[model samples]
Target: MQKALVSIAVAASLGLGATAAQAAILDDVKAKGYVQCGVTGGVAGFSAPDSSNVWTGIEVDYCRALAAAIFNDADAVRFTSLTSQERFTALSAGEVDVLSRTTTWTMSRDTQLGISFVGTMFYDGQGFMVREEDGIESALDLSGAAICIESGTTTELNAADYFATNGMEFNTVVFVDQDEVVKAYEDGRCDVYTTDSSALASERSKFADPDAHIILPEIISKEPLGPSVRSGDTQWFNIARWTYFALLEAEELGVSSANVDEQLGSDNPAIKRLLGVEGEFGAPLGLDNAWAYQIIKLVGNYAETYERNVGPDTPIGLERGLNALWSDGGIQYAPPIR
Candidate 1:
């Protein structure tokens, strides 16, 4: 069924438009009074369920941000936990409204999977992790080592590419889920673990002895992770994409949750336009003018979500790095709300 959907979508892109193309998912979500969001099942600081089965993470905040934009309520959202292999399938099958997991945005996935990426929520790179006791200080020493990785992710290709480029031979232990990959590495089934660098930090933070594992300094491939929605619905696409951009713009303009009410009386044109006090930007997308305002009011800004979930203070302990505001020596730029 997934393959058929992909084929039909590819055909449509090639001028073989299908008559059964889907209507706006945005309408369906509104009619349901909530947004169903797909999230990673176990990646710490990105998406994970607590003991009560309640989800909270940076990506979870993204889903909440969307809910706030639409419903003016952050809690009016549902989370569907998914593995790397199942995330895209669940999204394309309409099992979820939006995929806010740590899914990388790539050309093949965007074009061949009958899905559209909203925007990059996190900038990451592939790296390796190994036990500190292994006497291995760098990825270069893992030539003959067995590496554990999750299948159905860009990490697979990246691992292969990096190994081949360096003329190194290594055994690959692939798993259907990240949990198994982490477990396999923990159980000594593989000599090394590889994934997005931040993920390596996240996974290691969960270990019984985090200090025993060291992430190698080599960052191999770019992984721009973000949310995605099924294609054939331009309105839904716009809503998801702009929801992310709104958060970035909010951070860039210093319009945070605390000062948003105060900024309403200010004279800054960018702040006024972003909060919908001066423009009709939301109307064209079937949203009210206060869409962005509601998002920040309920879910806060991008930096707030990041700091709370995976910042240097969190157990995952990730710095903003490349995810900082564009004006602050980072690449996290967004289109103006105007």
Candidate 2:
């Protein structure tokens, strides 16, 4: 009978393609998503708080968007900042509900850390940053340069790998956290600063003289950053995963918070299902059809969030290269929200 209900639901709702399929509102996933990051001060576009004690960033908005999805209220989340060394342990120990700390999803973290990734929210790559006066035009030229990086991160390993593979030797000016890494680099303790290309740009944006530095053009390692939950909780995983994908699908469907009400009357089948207009698509997941609707209406679709928080017009100003929808030139394709 359960199988029959699910099958009927799938058929009736037209397959909720890339949509989050209204997941079950398990208490476990609910508690899991009530997440907090290590520090809200670093990673300008990913997570940071502003002068008014209000938090805002890509990762911050993601949490807000997710909270809206789960509880229908974006502000229903509480946060505690963790450091790089403490984030994973905190998640596993149930210290945070979700880890949206701009963390890279790697095999070790996935299989070994007892955590699971829902999907890739941001596709990035490791790169180097140097002062404009350094005359280091390419990563290939950074022979024997001291590079600043945060420990307890894949960035350290990736930096070593890139330098070794390129037959270049480099010195690592390691720090305990991202803030330390950035400060050490800014103080000229290291000849170069390295992290994801996006992070290099983000860090550079905060510099006293942002134009004094330049991020090299070369990308060293792929960094697929996203949200993570404890491994054993399937319900939480489903909810978080679908909630993220729903953002992408909403963007693809032209659903924006500003226009969501107008779209409630849309005749498009896909739009109807997404906005809770026609089918009970969210029923099986123990959610009302408005799960995605609330997310879209409150936090907006993927592009909207990205453009708002990290787009080219923003301080972080990331280009929608790989993050663009598959329909566009990028690989950011979400499953159909049937």
Reference-based lDDT, residue 331, model 2 = 91
What is each predicted model's overall lDDT from 0 to 1? 0.90, 0.82
Per-residue CA lDDT of candidate 2, range 1-338, in tens? 99989887896677443244223225644656554443344578888877876787778877887778777888777666777788889888877778888789999999999888888889999988999998889999998999998888888998888889999996898888788888898888999998888888888888899999999899988999998887765556777788888898888889899999999999999999888898876665566779899999889999988998889998888999999998888998777666
Whole-model alpha-carbon lDDT for candidate 1 = 0.90
Q: Tell me the spans in candidate 1 whose CA falls farther than 4 Å from its real position.
A: 1-23
Tens-digit per-residue lDDT, 194-307, candidate 1: 999988999999999999999988999999999999987777888899999999999998888998999887799999999999989888777888999999998888999999
- In terms of lDDT, which candidate is strongest? 1
RMSD of each: 4.7, 6.6
